[model samples]
Target: MSTSDFVETSYCLVFSNDKLRANIDTLLDRKGWRKEWEEYQGKLYLTVTAPFDLLAEEAERVKLEKKLNTQANSMARFHFSKFTHYRGYKNKMTFFSPAEQARLIWSALEDTPYSKNDFGRGVLPKFNDQFPFCTAMKSAPAFGLEDSYPLHSPWGKRRFNSNVSFRLVNLDHAVRDYFGEEVAFYFVWMLFFAKWLLIPGVLGLALYLFRPEGVTVDNSPYIPLYSLCVPIWGVFFVKFWKRHMNAVAFEWNAHDFEEEEELRPEFWGEKRISPVTGKIEVFFPEWKRYTRYFVSFLVMLPMLGIALGAMCLSLNLNNYIRDEESPLYIGTLAVFAQPGGIFAGDSPYYGYLVPTIAHSVVISILNTVYRSIAFRSTNFENHRTVEEWEKSFIVKRVIFEAFDCYLALFYIAFYRFDVVALRNELVGLFWGDELRRVGVEVIMPLLTMMFQRKRTTRKMRAEKKASNEKPIELSQAVLDAPLEEYDSFDDYLEMVIQFGYITLFASAFPLCSIISVGFVLVETMTDSLKLLYLYRRPRSRRAGGIGVWYSVMYFMVIASILTNCFILGFSSEQLMQWMPNMFKHEGGDQQFKLGYGRYVVGMVFTLEHILILLALVIEHFIPSCPRSVTTEMARRKHLAKQWLAEHEADASQQKTVQKTEHVE
Candidate 1:
């Protein structure tokens, strides 16, 4: 059938209140739809069912048609809002108001869209909004009580109930439908990482169990196996994830939505008259934007050099302080404290501690400053959309942030691995120092959480008193306040670094994997609670893919491979002893080459290239889009074309019959 023939021409009037039912019935009887009226919900209902060629009163038909059209549009918009659960933006638009959020939910009957009958399933529930808090609002026995009641622990206030079963499939559907594809993409990405980590965790545990003891200076046979497994697994994981994401995108209808995505809300441009519509249109200056972007790189390069220099200085100083045997320790002690004779041993720990603190402080400061600069630079460039602006900023930020974050590992793997040369060149740059830093990183999160909790409790008490509101029944006043939203990118970055520490330096610290696994398990639950209840829902964003982070992960995997190779080459005294001719040296007893010879360099270079090539080959073989999705899409197109052809044929037959009846 033609579009008009199949289109819905009638609408159902649904009323929740008796007064609204009476008013609508009176209005319909006075104007039109008097005969079409029927009893619904034991009150009144009106249906406008006018055929295109009806010989009835034209004026009455026209009036009824207008009313139906208006109501239909209103219903469509209301149903759209229901499925989205998008409480309108707050005055500041920084956060959503709970009062406004509660008001936005539509009555069930009004939210059932007409398209649902012909297209697909009706709207899925906005589960993110409905879970935990919404359930509590409905079921809390003390909700209307005046007196305070200790219902749950302060830390556990926002926790989701374990008994409230939530399927991953439903959660994924709800996230994509309400929050948009970009947020859903990250949700899936997190799930993928959580699942993929099991592989490495299992392998690492097995290796640890079978690890050879007292094998100093000798490479553990597991080192080569680990080096091979990491990159291979990384490549396979990335490919598998891409295929899975493609299937999800197709299932969610996000693949087509991406093509139709409008310019971001933040976009602005000069006005220009459109010839076709005779309307003013916003036009961006592409030339100006490109020029600013090109100039930004020049400005950024010098700033990057300064930041790198500061990081290098801090790392070297940290290493210097940790070395007890270094002459620099005496110099450091003389400069910073009393004479070297009085406090010789105390200085090394202090020395290492001071630089470690300085390193963190300097990086934090630089990160904040550079982020501000990057944001401003992106704004100055005048990108036409938020996505464009963010993409540029992320590129600049990720590059510097990755270097700032990973340089310590770089020093350990490349510089500190050579025990003799490293001792000669820079004192105190030991594997032990690296291990100490890892422990500090792991402990920092717990310390930060404790501090934050104390501060928040004090703030909540003061706010509650100032508001002069009745004290709600809760274990703590902090429960009344909204929990802070944690950034997904930041969380992912931390985990990536932890993964790097485990994989990249596993030779130096086998227990790193175990430590990371423990942290990941705790983080998985905490993060879920934060998303489900603690944090305000994020604004919808559209993402084609998990932008740039894949690159970051891949880089770490490759770096891990190189790091393992380096450790095997230099740090393994047994390997060096076994292959004494790997390097050349001038005549000296037990003094081999300090650096690799042509043969050794060539072998290492060839190995790295081969592994990289192998990864690329594996990736090439793995199809990004699943075969099933492709086949299904093709079948849908074919069926749609056949249906259209058949519909046209039926319409033509009907026209011929109508003409013959007119002739008779």
Candidate 2:
């Protein structure tokens, strides 16, 4: 091996400040680092681990040289990077030189530029070596985690590299549009959801605790309403939040970025469309092209229907199941309600569609408000070509609503139903809405699409974002267009059908669950296939699928809570009315006493919190850099260019080797 062989390829993440370092412990998975201090320049430096192959490449070197990206964007060495390659482990990262790394040692700590991203107060991740504030990683990649790029670090101050995926929303550099800071909107969303959950839940408790052990009619009618409220909260909060998302965009990024600077504001906080006509309004100029001025639906009509439908559905299902023998067995179920386990006269309150109207109308109003405002603003900003505008408004609306469906699914997936609702709604949820059944059938998949649309089309001025071809629209067109224009609908349908069949490979435990799962597989695949193969490609495009992961959370929640509900309800092992009942029954009874409801509640809350925290932690601790390796290579080009420039110039009139820029 040559002299270079002794220098292990260490990939150091360059930081402009301690802010990045503070987040790194929680944000990264691999743990090896060396922070070097520059004695002469008074700058701080860090050396990270990498395979040798990546280090030797000049492209990689220059890329890694820019640490922490604060050095001006125009500056050469101020960003995050990759450096070095290992000769032995071609599969791993290459790193930087070692002697240069020793400078981070405590004895050597002196004046050097340091990271603002870090705070010394928090926990430090275990790593191999420590040098004053800088250190070497203690461990390599976790098993099967090497490919995790930009692994999450436990460091907390919110680095871009952290696993949390947040949209900038609508930042316009000209004003304050910080969505996170919108306390009023958050309060409304929280209050509305709480209202639905709490009212009924409180009633349930009042009924449960204060009734003096009622033999009277279980006037727990509030249960279904409460159950219905969870989904309503899910839907309304999504729509309501989005209604103000533009405001967030303005507050957060308006100072830093202007998505559209074409339409300057006449006033500090307002825009003037017709100074002559006096049209002064605040709107999301980006979506103006896609917003239609007027589209109204009968708001309360569906709500009355939905509420009645749900109540009736519950009452009817109760009647239907009354005489019928339930071949019900205990098993884990999805977040949405479905039935199994023999219970006397248990109702499958399957018609959650009643609450559907409540949520949908609220959502429609929110959508309408924004659409009306944006459409009127079209007089001010030409966000899109007129022809494109005609095709865009509906696409945008459908995408939002549909994508909301997905976000709802995500909440349902992760949280047990009651937690997703107000604390009081758990009973009505289990008894009346049969949310599990309704969700599995109507909500989960709806939510899946909701998220899918959200992912694909979540960009600002989304309709005009040119790189994206609208799959939602194209799929719609393919189905609704003339047969002469496209001939392969059959083949398209077949592929989607196959997708459904493939999904069905994972079936449920019981015949009903198996059937329901199979049904869902077909429904999801067929609906997708129809979208892809059936109507004029929906003029609407999906924002894409940000909701998919959340949908998975809903699935998990449903799976867990349903399991708990099922096992408790079905097992011969339920708690009795009293301790004496357990011993005195002709057959032993393992009945649960009512006092344990709090424990059940605790379990669900802990489960939900831990899961979210786990994800947050994973994202924070595992250091998977978001940008591709190519971006890193681009940063390395400067160093290599200088080295080559000196290499060629050295031969001029007997130049010394010391004149070259290759310091190593």
Candidate 3:
């Protein structure tokens, strides 16, 4: 291949100093890595490429070891649109995506021993410690040209050939090609969710627009009906998502692709021979893990208390806004004086609006703070696998973030029985959080990139002056080096919280799904652009599905059923109006007088039990994998085994003939 082609397909490791470059170069060469070095702007850039033969060998080993699905043939190399193909037999050339090649290359590099110790450190960790100025170790595509024309070429320009499209499948392919299956799975699930959301989005819009006459939002019959339908929708949404995710996983050759989990490098424990692998591995005591869990819980309690304090402060401000006697009531009056009908002339909406804004802001800020703590706590727990650590982190996030996002809405809906405030709270939570996310995730990143670019450029010029070399433009690697590390946790958490808004309190505000649909579309595009342009290309990771997110949504689906049922029986005024006289007007204001207490409890439980049963039925009947996908997967496995048997038989016959000839 040409030099530019090799660079396009390789990973670039940029070093700020040359102290460990020679040792690193020798290690890479010994590990079968084909590398090229370029000195630019007084920095050393190493491009490491996996040789074709080595890549083919690694591909075969991975395919057999992991049982990765493949349909390999001579034509495989020619089809770019097909699921990626690899060399199935010896002396065959096959097309592997840059992502696939990167994985194989890294795996090879990771296997390089840095010491004679039994539990050896890899070249990467050893060199990171050895070279203080080593930086910018990322795939070439992070520094490669986009499809769009650019004015500069720090290296010879060769654009990555891929079209960006809004099509879910296409987007999944693009993301998987660049970022790997773990990140791609999230996008696929999100896009799939946004697509399915159209059903509820349209239904919610219709309910909002065509309610019966004299039906206020609180007393609207459509609200109860919509609330009931949403739980059922959530049930089927998750079931169908399971099928779709399975199909996608099958197509990607990763269906049920479970392997022995690798321990995180940070894990510390007594060394022991692993029962599963019979290999020397670190093992932490289970009792100590539990102790750490308890300690983490204790630390988290104070933070949760802080979250509760913020919520109470917001609620107090809300009550103050409504109570004209308070001194802060003057500020509330100013808010009521606003021109819009929703805000003008002592409107009740104004009471919830200002407080909800403050609540959302505090929740967002608190989430940022709690996230750091959550990470530290998860790390402290010292989970063995990355998956285990992530699961622990996800559970912690769900607990804190759910309280931060949903507790107030629950208070308004169940305790206060104020549908108006609940709807307003939903609107504020939805939009306020969205606005905050856009600022933090997208806008702020762009501004930071601009500032960092200027600062780095000046620093590079200063270095050039010290060397007395010609002035050179800063490279793409240098630009991306200062950007924040990309992770999908934040994006996944945001989606889960939004899912709660649309599903849990969907009855309170029917437009939630529609608004979220639009937001999701915009989010998909913005996230794609963010990953492509604004952040470093994250390392490739394997994943079979969306992982812990699926479980979170499953629980949320059940919670939606319970929440909606309570809203219908306890908070819904129109439902009460339709009920028998025996249950109506049991000594409360019109807004709160939904029913007699005992009957309402019975009714709520009855509906909740039925919905819960229905959800179970839906989950039971709908298979996780589609029949077609399962059949195709079976065919691939059958063919793989058949091919293996034939090869073995042929080799055996050849050995027999050679032995007979030698005896003669």
Q: Would you list the rank order by lDDT, best first? A: 3, 1, 2
CA error at residue 287 for candidate 1, angstroms = 4.1
Q: Model 2 reaches what TM-score against the true structure?
A: 0.26
Better of 1 and 2 by lDDT: 1
Superposed on all Cα atoms, model 1 deviates from the true structure by an RMSD in Å of 15.3
Pick the TM-score winner.
Answer: 3
Stretches of candidate 2 off by over 4 Å are: 1-305, 320-533, 538-590, 593-615, 622-664
User: What are the per-model C-alpha RMSD values against the true structure?
Assistant: 15.3, 24.3, 6.7
lDDT of 1 by residue, 1-664 (tens): 1333211223333222333344334433442231244332243333332222121123122211111122221111112112222223122121111211111211111122222122123221222122222221222222211111111122222222422234443444444444446666776776666677677667767666776686531245665555456656767777888888778866654454332222433345777887788766667878978899888878778778877677556544544334556432444433443334322325654444455455556665777788788887877787755567767887788777767755665665575554332222222222333343344333454465457666766665666688996543322223322234335665566566666665565455544455555555555545554554444344344465677777777777777667665655554342344466664434431334656556565766776777778877877887889999898667655654554465468778889999999999
* Full-model lDDT for every candidate: 0.49, 0.29, 0.69
The sequence of per-residue lDDT tens digits that candidate 3 reaches over residues 1-664 is 4432332345556655565566666666664666666565566666666666566555555552322235441111221111233343322222455566556655555555444132233323332322111221221122221111111112211112244544544777777766679888988988898999999999988876787887666666566778889989999999999999989988887776655565465666887888999867668999999999999999999999898777666655554235455433455434433455344425655544766776898898898899999999999999977679988998898899998888878877887787776776788778888998898889999898888888888888888899999889765555555666677888998998999888898788888898888899889878977876677766676788998789999999999998888878777574665664535454654433344667767877998999899988888888889998878777776776765665568778899999999999
